[model samples]
Target chain A: MAVYTEVTDEALAEFLTHYNIGSMVAFRGIAEGVENSNYALKTTQGDFILTLYEKRVDPADLPWFLGLMEHLAAHGLSCPLPVRARDGKNLNPLAGKIAAITTFLPGVWPRRVLVEHCEPLGAALAKLHLTGAGFAPTRANALAPDAWAELLAKSAPRADSVQPGLGGELAQMLHGIVANWPRNLPTGHIHADLFPDNVFFLDGEISGLIDFYFACTDIYAYDIAICLNAWCFEKDFSFNVTKSRALLRGYMAHRALSEAETAALPVLAQGAAMRFLLTRLYDWLNTPPGAMVTPKDPLDYYRRLRFHNAAQGPAAYGL
Target chain B: MAVYTEVTDEALAEFLTHYNIGSMVAFRGIAEGVENSNYALKTTQGDFILTLYEKRVDPADLPWFLGLMEHLAAHGLSCPLPVRARDGKNLNPLAGKIAAITTFLPGVWPRRVLVEHCEPLGAALAKLHLTGAGFAPTRANALAPDAWAELLAKSAPRADSVQPGLGGELAQMLHGIVANWPRNLPTGHIHADLFPDNVFFLDGEISGLIDFYFACTDIYAYDIAICLNAWCFEKDFSFNVTKSRALLRGYMAHRALSEAETAALPVLAQGAAMRFLLTRLYDWLNTPPGAMVTPKDPLDYYRRLRFHNAAQGPAAYGL
Candidate 1:
C-alpha cells in the first residue's frame, strides 16, 4: 500500500553507483511497506529492496532500525541485512529522502492467518526477544500507557460515533488498566507490531521477520500479548483459544515464562489491545476519507480488549 | 498503482502448481500496471510477472492480447512473452480473476523522456508494426475517432468546470477531427497507447516494449501520432521538433511512410490528441478528488491538440 516517491531511472543509476551491487537489471515500486517508498530492485549480482524513508518515518530512528536488523542477523536470526555502500554507509540521500538497500529475503507473508501459523510465529517472536538482549541500543515504546491519555482526549469526542458508549467504556478501561499496570517484568527489545504481514514464511516455516521500524524496548510478555491479539483472533474478532494455546506453548518451548509473567498475562493482553485500539481510534477519526491506506476498524481491537478484561488468568490463555 | 485483488500464499502456491516454473522463491505486489493486479514474482527457475486482469479489462479480449504478444516476440520483438502453464494455457484463474505469468523483461521504464529515447522508441514502434503483420486478430481500437463523439458528450456537461469555454472548444475540435479523419494509408496491429511508461530502456537503448493491453488493428501512422503526442512534447506542453524529427527519421529508416501518411500527420496527430483529451476529461470529471490514482490534466492534451491543429502539415513536426 505504498510507493509515495517516484525515482527517475537517471537518479537510480546514479544511486546504484554508490553501491557494489552492479548495474540495474530491473526495478519496480512494490506495494509492501506503508511508511516508506519501497522498490524491488534486481541487479547483476542479486535482488535487493530499495527503501526511501517518507516524512512519516523519523530519520533519526533509521540508523537504529538498520543497526538492530544487523544485530539480529548476526545473532542467527533470519532478517534483512542492510547493504552498506562502498563509502561504508547504509544510508544515503536519494530523491530528496534518505534511502538504503537491504538484501532481499525470499518468502511470502501469509495473507490469511491459519491455526498452524500461530506456533511458529510465537517461536520467532521469542527468538527475536532472546537474540535482542545483547544489542545495547534502547528505544522507549512510543505508544505505552503514558501516551494513552492524550490519544484518548483527541479521539474521545468521536469514539462513540463508531459505536455507542465506546468512549465511556474506553475511559473506564483506561483508568483501571493504568492503575493495575504490571511492573518488574523482564524488559528487552520487542517488535511491537508483529502482524502476519510482517512475518514471511516458506514451506510452512517462518523464513524471515521484517519491518523493524516499530521495534522498541518493552516487557517481553507484552510482545507476546501483541502477538496473541494479532495472530490468534478470527476475522470476526473472536479469540481462538486453540491458536492461543499453541502460541504460548511455542513461546514456552523456546524460553520458560516466569510465574509472575504468567499471572500478568490477562492485564498485559488487555493493555496490548488498548494500545492498538487507541492508535487505531485516532487514525480512524483523523484519516481523510478516500486516502490510499484505509484505517483499521478500532472496534476490532475493542472486542479483543473485552475478551482479555474478562479472562481469569494465564489459564484463560491456555498456558 | 494497482494490486486490487489479494492473493493468499496458499492460493498462490496452488496456482503455481499448474506452471513448470519452479517453486516460489519470492513474490511481492508491484505498483506497476494500472489496469490490473501485478506482482513481481521470482521462482526457482527465473523471474516473471504475475498479472491478474481486473474488471476494467474485457475477458473476451484476453486471447487477442496474448496472441499479439506472442506474435511480436516470435518476430524478434524485445517484449514480454506470455509463459504458458503445464496445460499449454497462458491464462488461468487466481484470486477470482483471470491471471497469467509473462517472462519478466529486464529494464526500467524511463521516468523522464530524453531526446535519445525518442529515436529508438520510434524504431521499435515501426518494428512492432512490421512484425505484427502476421497477427490476424482484428480488435477495434476502443478509443478511436468513432468513440470520441460519445466520450465528448459524456464529459461535455462539466468540461467547462476545468476551464471556461473548454467544453465548446472540445466539441468543435472533436467534430472537425472526425470529419477530416484520413482514410487508411496502411493498416496493421498497432500499440495504440505507446506511452513512455510502457517502453523500457537499458543503457540508452530501448530494451523492450510492454503493456500491450491496448494493442489493436489501426493505421500505422496513427500510432506514430500517439508517439509524437507522448514523447515529443516538453513538460510545459511545447512541441520539441528536434525530438519529433529524430523519431520520424528513425521510423522512416525502418518502414518508410507514404506521401499520403506524411500529408495526414497534422490531422492524425490532432486526432490522437483529441482522443486522449476526451478520456482525460471524462476521468477528470468522474474521479473523486482524493482517489488513489489522480487523473491526468486534460489541458496538457488540449495544448497538444491546439499545436497539431495549427501545424502546417508534417513539416511542423520537422519531417
Candidate 2:
C-alpha cells in the first residue's frame, strides 16, 4: 500500500489520543497492497490497522467507509470498528488527508475454503444483504450497468488484435449486451469487492468480512453472481457445477431468491463478468510503467465472459 | 494517498534527491492503490509518477520490475521510464519501502470503449509480445497457474457447497490446459493485465502501454486472450463472437501466430478465463471490510469460459 508521508511515532501517538481503541504500542507496515499505506498497529489500546487514505481512495468516502463498519458491527456482522476521536467523530483528518485507527479483528483469511464455509459466507452475505436493505445510508454502484457501454465504447478502438475481422465482432458483442441486460432487478447494497484477501476465518468459521468501499445499491442477486464466480469455481478456471450448487444452495438457504431474481441470474452474471473484464482490461491498458503495481491478465476474465454468454440458464450454474 | 507524515516540503525535497528523475519541482499524492502510492510529480524535467513501493512489493524482485520497464522502453513501447537515483540506481529505499519515479505519457482512459480500438490494442500487444520475447528480467509469474491452484486449495474448504468430487474434474481440466499451454510457442514478456484502465491512448491512438508488473515469460498469445476478454467484449457481459474475432484479428496483424500458438488458442483462453474467474471468486470471498476496492463478478466470465470450453477451432475466434 502507498504510504506517501511517513507518520512519526509522536504523530501517531498524538493521533491516537482521541480514539478509544487503547494506547499505541507498536506498529508494522503491511506490504501487501498497492493502494494505501497500512500499518498493523499494536497499541496498548488494542490491535488495529492504521491507514492513511491514499489518493486512490477518495477522501470524501472515508466517513462512509468507516461509518459502515460501525453500523455493520452494531447490526451483527463482526468487523474492524473505527475508533472515533475525542470529538465524537470516527474521522481524523491528518497529513492533508484522512487517517483512522480501526480495531483489528482476530481471524486469519482462510487458505483452504470449503463448501461448508461457503454456506456461512452465503448465509452471512444474505444477512448482510438483508441488513443493508433499506439502510438509511445509501450509495450507488460505482460501476453500474449504465456505464458499461460507455466504457467499452471508448476502449474498443485501442484493442490489439490477431484477427482480421475481430474488431467488428467486438462491436457487435457490445451492441448485443446493450440490447439484452436486465434492469429493474432488486436494488440494494452489494459488497462489490468480496475477494479472499478481505475475508477472515477462525477454526473453519467465517469470523468476519472487511472492505466495503465498493458497497453500493445495485441488483442484490448480482452480489450472488459475484460470489458464484469467486467461491464455487476451481483454480483450473472451470466451473465446478456441484460446488457451484453448494455455494448457491448455501446462499438460497440464507437469502431465498425471488422468482425475478432467479430469472435475472444469467444476465446479471454476464453484467458482472463484463464489469470485471472491463475493469481488468482498463487497468491492464492504463497501468503506468515503472510502478510497483501489478496488472491482472485481462484474458483471465475474458474466459469468464465467455462462460456467462452461453450459459443455458441459471440452472446451468446450479442456481 | 495517505500522507500521514506531512513533509515540511523541505523534507520532501531532501528525500527526492535520492530519486532517479532529473528534478522534482513539485509532488503530491495522487492515488492510493492496493499496492502502491501514486503521486503526480511535476519534475523540473517532466511529469512523472513518484511511486513509493509499499511493504507489499518484495524488495528482492524490485530489480526485475525496474528492469522490465527499461526493457519495454528499449523495445520502443511508450511507457513510464524509470528515473535513477544520483548513485545511478533505479531502486531507492524510502519510508521503510522501495520507491521510484517514472516519466508520464499522455492519454485518457476511454470513458467508453469502441470496437475499432480492439485491433490496434491487439496489434500493439503483439508488438509487446515480440519485443518482450526472451527478455527475461527477474520475477516469474509469482501468481502463476500453480499458485492459483494453491490459492484455490486454501479456499476450497470454504466453498459454499463444495463437492470435492468436482476436484477430479477440475484436476483433469487443469491437466488438459497445462499439457497444451503455449509455453515454448513464443516466449515473451506478456502484459498480463491489459485492462482498459491500464492501456493509455493519445488522440485515440495507442500511445503507451503500462503496468508490466504482471509481465512474465509465457505464450504471447495468452496475452491475446486477456485482451479479447478485455477489449472485445461489452460491459453487459456477453461474449461477442464478432468482437472476439476483431481483437484476435488485431493481434494476428502484428505477429503471425504459430501453429502451436494457434492450436493452443482455445486452451489458453480457457486457462485465462479460469484464472480471472478464480481470482474474482477469491476476491468475492475475502473482501476486507472498509477497504474501497471492488471485487469483480465471476459470472461475468462464465460465458467466456464456456465458449473456450466448447471451442471447435481457432477459426471460432477468427485467429
TM-score of chain A of each: 0.97, 0.90
- lDDT by residue for model 2 (A1-319), tens: 3445556544565687777776654444454445676666655544567777778777776777777777778788877778777788877766566787776665544434556667777777787787766467777677887786677666566555423443455566656666777777777777877765567665456778877767777778888888776776666677777766776776788778888888777777777777776776667667664344556766665666667778878887876
True contacts kept of each: 0.70, 0.02
lDDT of 1 by residue, B1-319 (tens): 7788999999999999999999998889988777889998889998999999998789999999999999889889999899999989999999899999999998899888889988999999999999999988789999899998888999998888999999998888888988999996899999988999899999999889999998899899999999999999998889999999999988988999999999999999999999889888888888774455656789999999999999988999997
lDDT of 2: 0.67
lDDT of 1 by residue, A1-319 (tens): 7888899999999999999999998888997777788999999999999999998778899998899999999889999899999999999999999999998998999999888888998899899999999999998888898889889999999999999999999999999998988999999999998998899999989999988888899899999999999998888888899999989988888978999999999999999999999988998898775565657789899999999999999988887
In order, what lDDT does every prediction score? 0.91, 0.67
**Could you tell me every candidate's TM-score relative to the true structure?**
0.95, 0.50
Residue A156, model 1: Cα distance from true site in angstroms: 4.0
Docking class of 2: incorrect
Candidate 2 stretches with Cα past 4 Å from truth are A1-5, A111-113, A161-171, B1-319
**In terms of TM-score, how similar is model 2 to the real structure?**
0.50
Q: What is the TM-score of chain B in candidate 2?
A: 0.86
